[model samples]
Target: MLVRRFKKSLLVLSIAASATVAHAESFNRIASFGVIHNLPEGTEQSQETSPEIIAASEDGNTLVYSDSPFEALGFVDISDAKNPVAGGIVKLDGEPTSVAIGGKTVFTAVNTSKSYTQPSGYLMALGLQERDELVRCDLGGQPDSVAVSKDGRYVAVAIENERDEDLNDGEMPQLPAGWVTIVPVENGQLQCDKMTKVDMTGLAEIGATDPEPEFVDFNSRNEIVVTLQENNYLAIIDAASGKLVNHFSAGSVELQGIDTKKDKMLDFTDSQTRLREPDSVKWLDDNRFVIANEGDMNGGARGFTIFHKDGRMLFESGASFEHQVILAGHYPEKRSGKKGSEPEGVAIGQFDGETYIFILSERASVIGVYRDTGDAPEFVQLLPSGMAPESAVVIPQRNLLVSANEKDLIEDKGPRAHVMLYSLTDAPAAYPQIISTRTSEGTPIGWGALSGLTADPAKPGMLYAVNDSFYANQPTIFTIDANQTPAKITAATLVLRDGKTAKKLDLEGIAADGQGGFWLASEGKTSKEIPHAIHHVNSTGEIDRTIDFPKALLANEKKYGAEGITLIGDTLWIAIQRPWKDDPADQVKLLAYNLKTNSWGAVRYPLESAATGWVGLSEIVSHGDQVYIIERDNQLGESAVVKRLYSVSQDQLKPAAIGSDLPLVKKVLVHDFMPDLKSLNGYVQDKIEGFTVDAAGNGFAITDNDGVDDSSGETLFFSIGKM
Candidate 1:
C-alpha cells in the first residue's frame, strides 16, 4: 500500500509539473472582497462577520453568502470580475448556515436552535432582487447545508441537530435525530406547505439512532446526497418523493507518509488507519460523488474520497493532496495530530468542456484543483485561499470560482473574512511562487515560516533560508534553487549541535560564511530561554562555535533581537528587529561584529513611522556597494503601510561602542514591496521577512507564513528583478 501511495504521489507531481510548464488554462485569483465591507452604514466595522456558504444569481452578476456571526445574508456585485463591489447585506431573523440560489429566489437555511436538545431552524426563501423574505418553512431542526435542484424544482436542506461538545465530550446519540427536508419550488416561489421530512434514523453503523446529516447536494437525477458527519455515514434520497434510495458507511482509509505528531516538526513518516467522517459532499455526476473527509468526531482521513454512489469507493486521494500542500510550503504542521490540511469543502465545476474538482484544505488555506478523468482524478494545480474556506461556488458561464472564507480574525487584528474570486484563463498558475522537491526517500521536504534568506556568493540563483522559532524543535537551513519558476527548496539541512537537533533557537537570519559554511542569528526570547546570540556552522549543519551578545548589549536586550545578518569582509552585520531599552523611539541598531577583531559595535538606523503598528527591520543583505534591508510594519491587510526595501551605502559602516551615541546611517528607498505582495490578489502579508540578492544581482524576497497557525499559510516568494 505504501508503494502504491508513493507511485500515486509521483504521478501527481509529474502532472502538476507538466501543467505548470505547458501553460495549461488555470484559475488565478483576481480579487478579494472583505465581508466587513457589506455592512450597512453606521455599523461598526470591528464587529465579527463571516462569509461561509455562497451562492450566485442565475445571471452570475451577484453573490450572496451566509454570515452566521452577524445574523445576516451578505451580497456582492461581481459583474466586474476583476473588481468586486459590496452589495450590502440583509438582516435575517436567525443565523444563516447555508444558502442556494434557484431561479429568482434565494433559499437560505437558517439555524434558530434554542439548544442541541431542542434543535429548530427554518428554510427561508427570499427574493433575489428585492431582498424580501418570500417564505419560511420550519425545518424542526438546526439546518447545516442547503442545495437547489438542477431544474429548480426542489430545494434540500440537511437538518443537522448537532451535539453539544461539552456534553459527553461531543459523542453521538444526542437525541432529536436529524433528517432531510425537501421543499418544492414553482415559479420562483417556495411551496412551504408541501415540504417533506425524510427520516434518516437507523441508517448508519455509528450513531444509528441520531443521524446528524451534515451537508446536502443534488444531482441531475434529483437525488439528494447527504453526509452524516459525526455518524460517519452517507445516504441518498429521492428529492421528489422524499424516499431513501441508498445508504452506506463513509468507510475508513489507511493513510501513509503523513505527519501524525504536532511536535513543531514536519515529519511525514507516520501512518494511521482512520474513519472518513466526511463533512462536505458534491456530486461529480449522477452516478458518482466526492466527499471531503473532514473527520469531526473520532476520525478524519486527512484527504478526500470519490464514490460510485453504489457503495463502491472509486478513488481515495489518501495523502496525495496533503503531499502537494507540503511541497507548496502550506502544510499546517500544528494540525498534524488532528488532520493535516483538513480537506473540508469540495466543489465541482464544469468549465468549457472539462470537469474540475476543487478540494479545499481548511487548515492549510489552499484549494487543490483536479481534473476528473471518470476513473481517477488527474492532479492539476493548487489555489491559495483565504483562511478556513468553508464553501465554494463555481460560475461556469463567467469562468469564475468563488470561495467563502469563514474565519474572521478581527479579534486578533488579522485579516477579516474574505470572499476570494478566481478566473479560468489561458495562463500558468501564479501562486506557489516557491515549492519544495522530494527527498531521496520520495517524501516531501516540509518547510514553512521562512524568516531569513541569503544568497551563495559564487552561485547565481542559489539561495538559503531558515525557518524561525515556529518550528523551534527543528531549526533548518533550506537550500533554494531560485532558477526555477516557483523557486524550489532542493534540500533541507538540519542545524545540529553535538550531533543532536538544536532546540530553543529562533533562527531569524542567515548568511554564507564564504567558506561553504553559514553564520546564523538566533533571536532571543528571555522568557523562553533562547539567548540572543550568533553561531557559525559548516556545510554539514554542525555548529562549530557560538557567540553571545556583549554585556552592554545584553543589559538592554529585548525580545526583538537580531532579525537578519550579512557578512562583509572580516565583519558581520546584524539588523536588530526593534529598538532596545536605551535606543530612541524611531531608531533600531545595526550591530557589527568583526570576526578578526572579536568585538561588537553598533550604528542606529532610522525607521519609517507607521500610522498604526510599530515598524522594524526584518532582513538585511549585502550586494554590490549597498546593503539592502526589509522594513515592514506588524499590521496586516489594509492597515499595513510600510513593507519596503531600503538600501544604505557600503561606505556608511561607521560603528561606535554600544553605550556611546551611535551615528544614524542615511537610507535610500530602494523599492516598495506592497505591489509585489499584492500581485497574487491576497491581502498584503505583513511579514516580508526574507530578502537577498543573488550572484547575478537579481533580488528575491519572501514572507513568513507563521507556520500556518492562525495564518492563511501563504508563503509568497517572488523576485523584484535585478538589484
Candidate 2:
C-alpha cells in the first residue's frame, strides 16, 4: 500500500509537470494580415472593412475572405507564410456573407435583401486564377453560411432570411421561413440549373413556421447539417437527394460557476440554465459533429457541444472552456452578463493523422484548441487572435491555421480588422505568458488589465500586480509566481474598504511598504468623481489611509495622474501619465511625497516626441540606485514607434515646490520594448503598463488589455532577464 501511494503521487506530479512544460508539437502565430491592406488603389484607406468568413486555396498559397462592410471579396497571397502580401479585392454586387473554395473556383453567398420581409440572395462562382465570374444561382433568400462537400460534388448554403430585431424584441415566427439550398458541381463547375431547395418549415419545436438557418456544413456521406440559431434547432439533410435525414432540438444546459452580471466583477458562482443556440457546425466524421453554442435571442450555453449523427450527446463543455479563458486573463468581463466568451466558430482539421478541433471565442478574442480522442475532446492550448474572431480555416497540409477577425476599430482608432496565421511547429506555446491558478473552490482566479506590478521585497520571482479602472468595482491585487515557464497567479486579494470590495478606485501602480503592507496609486478622473490619491492598505487588503494631492498641484491637474508609485526611504515617488495644463511641451511631472515631512514636490521628466500620437509614462520602479520607467505611445500595430524603458539615477531625486520650476532629469536608455512586443508575432500593443525588478534582479514587464473592451484581450507578460 505504501509503494502504491508513492507511485500514485509520482503519476500526479508527472501529469502536472507535463502540462506546464512545452509540447513537442504546438501551434504558434507566425503572421498577421490586416484586411485593409487588400483595399483597392482608388478606395479610401480610412474606409471600414471587415473579413467575416475565410477560405484557402487547394495549394494553400492563397486565401480568400468575404469583406461584408466593403461589399467585396478580398484575397491574400501567403506563398511566403511569414509575410503575406495583398492580392487585392474583387468588387461584388451585394454583401458577401460567406465563401468556400472548390478546386480552382470560389463560391460566395451574397445577400441582396433590401429588407427582412423581402429576402433574396445568390450563390456566385468566380474563377480563382482568372478572378472572373463564371456563374450565379439565385438562392431566393438571405444566405448566412456556405460550405462545399468533402468530395467536391455539392455546395450547401443556409438561407437565414433573418427577422428584424426591432419588430418584436428579436422574437421568432416573424419570417417568411428559411430553407437549405444545395447545388450540384460537375467537372469543377457549379451547375446553377440543378439546384435543389430543401423545405425546413414545421421541423423545429420552436418557431416551427419560421425556420432560420444560421450555418451549414457537409460530411463525407454528402449529408448537410444546418443550425437554426434563433430556433435552437439542428437538422440533417441528404445533400444528394435533398431529403430530411434527421432533426432534433439543440437543447439547453444547466450552467454553474459562471459570471452572470455586468457589475465589473469576476464572480463565478452564479448558476443558470441556457439553451445551446449553436451558431457554427462542423462534422468530425460521418458519425459525429460539433457545434459552437453562441446563443441568440434567449440562449447561449457559453461553450461547445458534440453530438452523434443520431442525436446522442457525446460531450458537453459546459463552463470548462470559459474557465480556461478566465485563467488566461482573456475573459471579457463586459460580456459577463450575456454569453461569456461566446464560442461562435468551430473548425476541424487532421494534421499528420491527428484530428484537432479549433473553437473561436467571439468576445474574448482567443481560440481554444482541443484534440479529438473519439469519446471526449482533450483541451490543448489557447491561441491569441485578433479582435472579435468570426471564422477560422485550417490548412492541415501546410500545418497552418487562419482566423478571420471581423472587428474593424477604425471609428475608435484602434487595431483594424485582421486575419491571423499560425503554424504547427516543434516548439512551446508562446501565449498566455501569464495565467492564473484555480482557487480553493477549484474556480479559476479571474484577472485582466494588469496595470501595475511590484516585486516582493524578500521573495525572488514573486510579484504583485493591480488592475486598473476597467474592473472598477472589484479592485484586486494579484499575487504571481514568476518561477514557472508561464508565470502563474497564485492568489487574488480584493482591495476592500470597511469589509466590502472597494469602489471608485482606478488603481494603476503598486509598491511594497516593507512592513507587510502596500502603497497603491489611483489614477483619477474628476469628471467621474474619482480622486487622484494614494492609498495605504494592510496585508489583509483593507485600506488604512488615503493621501490626496496638494491643492497647489490640483489647480492644474489633468485626468491622467499618478500612473506609478515607488518607495525610497521615507519618500514615495509617483510618475504622472501625461502633461498637465501647467506643464511644458513634451514633459510630465514625477511627483515626490516625503512621508516624514508630509510635503509634496515635483520634477519634470522629458518624454520622446511621437510622429503621430502623444507619448507618456506608464510605470516607474526603483531598483538598486536606478529608477526605471516605462515610456510608451498610444498608437498600435505598425504605427507604434515608442515603447521603451529608461532609467534615471537616484542622485537626481532633487525636487522643487509644486508651483516652482521643476528640475529636468536626464535619463539613460535601458531597453527598447518594441522588439519584445513583436516577438510574440502579434500587432504592437499600445499599453506596456507594468515593470518591476525581482529580488534576483530580473526585470519583468506586462501589458494592459483594457478588460478586453475593444481590444484583442491578450495580456503579454514577459521577462527581460537580469537588469
Q: What TM-score, over all chains together, does every model reach?
A: 0.97, 0.97
Question: Least lDDT summed over 10 consecutive residues: which range in candidate 2?
Answer: 1-10
Candidate 1 stretches greater than 4 Å from native: 1-23
Error of 1 at 351 (Å): 1.0
- Candidate 2: what lDDT? 0.90
What digit string (tens of lDDT, one per residue) describes model 1 on residues 1-723? Answer: 000001122222223422233346989999999888999999898989989899999899999999998999999999898899999999988899999999889999888888879888889899999999888988888888999999999999888888887888877789989889999998978888999999999888898999988899999999999999888898999998999989888888888889999899999999998888999999999989999998978888888888877777878888888888899989999889887788999999999899999999889999989998886788888899998998899999999999999889998888799999999999788988999988888888999999999999999999999999999889999999999888899999999999999887999999998889999999999888898999999999999999999988989878799999999899999999999999999999999999999999999999999899799999999998899999999988888889999999989988998899999999999999999989999888999999999999999999999999889999999889998
Model 2's TM-score against the true structure: 0.97
What digit string (tens of lDDT, one per residue) describes model 2 on residues 1-723?
000000011111001211233457889999999888898888897899999899999999999999988999999999998999999999999999999999989999999998989998999999999999999999999988999998899999999888888787777798699999999999878898999999999988889999989999999899999999988999999998999999999988878789999988899989998999999999999989999999888889999988887887777888888888888999999888988899999999998899999999999999998888886677778899998899999999999999999989999999999999999998889887999988788777889999999999999999999999989988999999999878999999999999899887999999999888899999988899999999999999999999999999999988899889999889999999999999997899999999999999989999999899799999999999999999999999989999999999999989899999899999999999999999888889999999999999999999999999999999899999999
